[model samples]
Target: MRAVVFDQFGAPDVLHVATIDRPEPAADEVLVKVKAVAVNHVDTFIRSGGFRTNLATPHVAGRDLVGTVVAVGEHVQSWQVGDAVWANSLGYDGRMGATAEYVVVPAERAYPLPAGIDPIQLVASVHSAATATIVLQSVMQAQAGQRLLIEGAAGNVGRKLIQLGHQRGLTVVTTSAPRDFERCQALGSTQTVNYAAGFESHFQLADQRFDHIIDTSGKVALATNLGLLKQGGQVTLITAPKTNQFTFPVRQFYTRQQRISGFVISHATQDQLATAAQWLNHAFAAGLLLDDQVSVQPFEAAAACHAQLEQGQDHGQRLVLVPSK
Candidate 1:
């Protein structure tokens, strides 16, 4: 098996493909012959040691994969030897990843892939779309006919939120660069605002308040944006400030009955992954999700992909890797 491994992570150059022994499935796990894997910002964070989690060195970098099951554990009764599956690899929890020819995933974490879906598109959706699902379906409990404002709408999770928001029948407004407005609109945003022009000057064209706001920008303050929400509206943060603590305005929060929460997909459980996988499978099968815009690269280009991601050059396209033959 050839895996992308980083012995001491500092830069993208530290990541390299190495031939290693293939891993076998445990009693509760399954071995997948890797087909495609998506590269995420979290992969960079973990590799560079910027994330808060403690990881073993020489880490195999990646989290989400689309693959075919080659072997299942003796106790695994639900899946078979030839099932096409997609999974969140749980890489942050010291689990092996899919940036290789093979990977071992906990049986509960892997889900059968929907037919007629592209492997690249399915892999792209797993990590980011799952987080959006958690925020909308679980945290916000968003309802149809509601309104949502998605901050940083052009990024990976932000793009998924727009599509997911539409699926839930929400009127979606998004923030992004002026150049990305059309792209956001094509993804189903009813309104798009360029935050670079000025956050306050451009965010809202109407006097309407949003029912829910999800901030993926990581730079916005909850205190500053609270007024944009309607009374009893919810705000969810996928990204936070450097300090991790935000200044909560008690008076405003109490007066408007606004609610706020933060979510990190790294902390997601096996059950959550299963739920997300099921939902995504249906979404892809229904023609709600497509692979036309996803970026494909050879698996060996992982390091170069990481560099482009770090410099903020790669946006608007979900990058997935196909294993090199």
Candidate 2:
């Protein structure tokens, strides 16, 4: 199998397409024939040695993929050969990944792909949609009719959050660059705050305090935003800060019962992934999730794609890699 492999972490130049042994399924896993996979920020982060987990040499570079099942392990009774499926890459913490002709995924992490759904669009939506769904459904416990604010809402996850908020009848407000204000509105954001000016700009236009706030941007101003949250409100941080520290209004936080939470999708349990997958499958079948903005490239162009992403050249579209023409 030819795969995008990296022996060391540094720049996109470290990645290359090379022949590697195809992976076999374990007792609880299934072997998938690769079709299309997505290149994500975490893939770049891990490739550049930014994550804390110890990396194994010759690591594969991809996170989410859609493909057909070629084989199943003895214990994998729920799936069989020829079932179309999609899954998050099991590539972190010394596990093998999906950027190859074949990859193995634990059965629980793989979800059935609905008929008539385009694999390219499905791959683009998997990671970001799942992350936003888990955060809104599980972490933030967002409710309909509540006011929710999303910071840095121009990215993939932020767009999904806006759509999900609208589907649930929540009033969704977001902070984004002026360039992305109209795009965010098209994705269902009720209000757009020009964060390029300042966070105060968001506060200025808000008519009411938010019940929940989700910060997709790593830069957080918890101290200044505490006043923007209503009593018993919550804030969810999707990314870590550079300084690895955060300061907030401790007195107000305690007095108003406000809460802060952070999580990485890499740590999601099987149930969480399943819940997200099921929702996405239904959404796709219902023609609800549209990812026409994604960019598709050849699998062998992994290195160039990573470079483009690092240079901010994607123009806010998810980049996907198809294994072949």
TM-score of each: 0.90, 0.91
Candidate 1 lDDT over 260-289, as tens digits, reads 887888876667767777777778888765
Runs in model 2 lying further than 4 Å from the true structure: 54-58, 198-207, 240-246
What are the candidates' C-alpha RMSDs? 2.5, 2.2
Lowest-scoring 10 consecutive residues by lDDT in candidate 1? 197-206
Q: How many residue pairs clash in each candidate?
A: 0, 0
Best by the TM-score measure: 2
